[model samples]
Target: MRFKSIVLVSHVTDLSGPSEAVENYLKTRSDRLGVIYHPFHYCADRRSRMQDYRGGTLLREARQGGWNLPALATYVKDALFTLFYFLRLGGRYDVYLGADPLNTVVGVVLKWLGLTNFVIFYTIDWMPERFSNKLLNAVYHWLDRFCVRHCDAAWNISPRIQDVRRSQGLPDAKNVLVPVGVDLEKIDLPDKSASEPRDLVLLGALAPSKGVDLVIDAFPRLKERFPQLRLHVIGKTPHDAVEDGVVYQPYEPRLAALGEGVILHGAKPHDEVLAMLPAYDVALALYKPSPNNLSQWADPSRVKDYLACGLPTIITPVPEIHKDIAALNAGIVVDYAVEPLADAIGRMLADPGQWRSMREAALAYMRSYSWSSILDRVFEESFRAKA
Candidate 1:
């Protein structure tokens, strides 16, 4: 039987990945689906917001910082607000998909209360130590395991998460791989013979674990070899010094030192990022090695976007997608180091024939990851009748 009515709950920091994909897909069924989003704004000037959508239309959207509290407090407040908002809507839905653990736990509670039929725990990122605080970290994992064992199904963004879960001996949650997908319809392939000094791009937040510093350190040597080569670093950096499993630092000065060789375009809209990917010859996803690095358990959406736009990527073996990319010859997988990353970029730029061939492979591989097809498979597997 097909699910007639659904609602998706997710925390929004940016317009990216699985959340955006799922929301867009559900909107097509606007007659029956709903969406609840809690957007967290880092800048004090930008207030937190809550958005509610139903029957394919936005029912309410509110923005205010009346309760401008600390990060932990904000999160707790958001969870309560989500519960109240669903209750306000009569609290009934056929399917409820929540992105992060906290959001999914809310759904599980609603299910326990007989307000929702099927609850999906959509695992986006899993780090060994999710929070720096010992008590909070323990609480986070307890909630995660609780959701997995209790939810109707656990939708892991990567297969590795399933493996990780089993290793932890968590009770069998009906696990499904709902990997990150690309918007194929919007992305046009870059011109194969576009002459260069070709450029490289790295998308998403410029975090320490994201390997932005490694990229910066390697840029000078790369620029010396190919005088006209440019590196486009997209997305924002930490607004303040904070610790949440990973340390945050200000890297604006370091980026500024590179001048014309490195172009920093901070946090563009997701659609704009898609539009800009095709112009670059190579994409970078060099995640640094750390036991707590979240990328290790993620199926990164940026890599998918790069492949969809027909740009061969230079990635570290941190994400689950890297294995497929390496196997398909769609991209180069290197250690999370400056030299390997720089060399990988050089190889892609110096050899026109190899880059073109890899670009073809990337496009071919990405066809399987279109949002429509991926979500269709997810629902089919999720809601399939058992005899």
Candidate 2:
């Protein structure tokens, strides 16, 4: 059976990993899919830069603290555009899928305004509690409740987030857990490649929540045992500080000074990052527990990425990873503490035979999480049946 049409609305465009994954999934299965994405503000091309009409007003408001007039104006304009887009394609679509709270809100409002039919709200992470103050949190909580109650179905990246929605009293709640899946075909590993001298490689955004500091602290101890061991950190620094007086900056110089083997390669495109995965001995995922960490409560996307690359992982014992590690025997888990983390990395690196075995085990485990399998389930359970 074919969908009449599927409408996707998200803040991120096709350029982002999450958006690209979802878009690719829908495009592969259906010809009647259309997308309405928020303007891309970070594109370098001049023509593409003009596509984001929201930035001008936001920049002006950054100079002065109160209500951001320009940002509000941009949001209003986008909402209007969404309304027009919804009406244009409303009759042809069987379902509307939105990623994130803002997009969900827009979809719900458009539906309420008689612009569309079935609405599916996809939750990548928990919102309000993660990013809002007390008053805004209350408002967002009510908004989430409203969306969950009104939408035909809810799609969450993890079961943990589904629990959060269920607790909020959503009725007939169809919580579909759709964790990001691995594209096995894209992640090709070299069979007889020489391993880098590095003991651990941490990949993903270089934010505090990702626990870059923990890895840095752990590196010194790991280096003591294997003097030639190196730690390579790959990802972009945050543009602004999440905490007070703690500005985000590149960790290269600071980390390099602490040891001889710490190298920060900054952020590269997703394909480039995946290409380097095979060269490393182990993939380290040391995210600290935080409000912003919806993935910490659920399954992290990077764990699948690491496994797809056939690399043994050393991750903190987050609930999701803990369960997977035990079931799959894919990698090692340790406490988030520095001493244990260092010990875990050292243990994996010290034994080549064990490391090789774990690598094969990780690949075997990752086979079940290919995008085709996961997306097929998501389509059947979340969208097709529900609609």
TM of each candidate vs. truth: 0.91, 0.81
Cα RMSDs of all predictions? 2.6, 6.1
Q: Write the per-residue lDDT of candidate 2 for residues 1-387, one digit (tens) a residue.
A: 245567777655222455557666676555466666664322221011111112112111111111223434544565555555555543335567877666788878767766667788888767436544566567556767778877878887777777787787754337777877877777878773334335578887676767788877877777777888877877755433344235676666567777678777877776677788877778888767655665565666777788888878877766476578756767887777888887777777776777787888888888888777777787677655454
Q: Pick the candidate with the highest TM-score.
A: 1
Model 2 steric clash pairs: none
lDDT of 1 by residue, 132-169 (tens): 77888898899898887777777888778988767756
Model 2 local distance difference test score: 0.66
User: Which ranges of candidate 1 are over 4 A from the true structure?
Assistant: 1-3, 40-48, 64-68, 166-173, 194-197, 241-249, 385-387
TM-score of predicted structure 2: 0.81
lDDT (C-alpha) at residue 46 in model 1 = 38
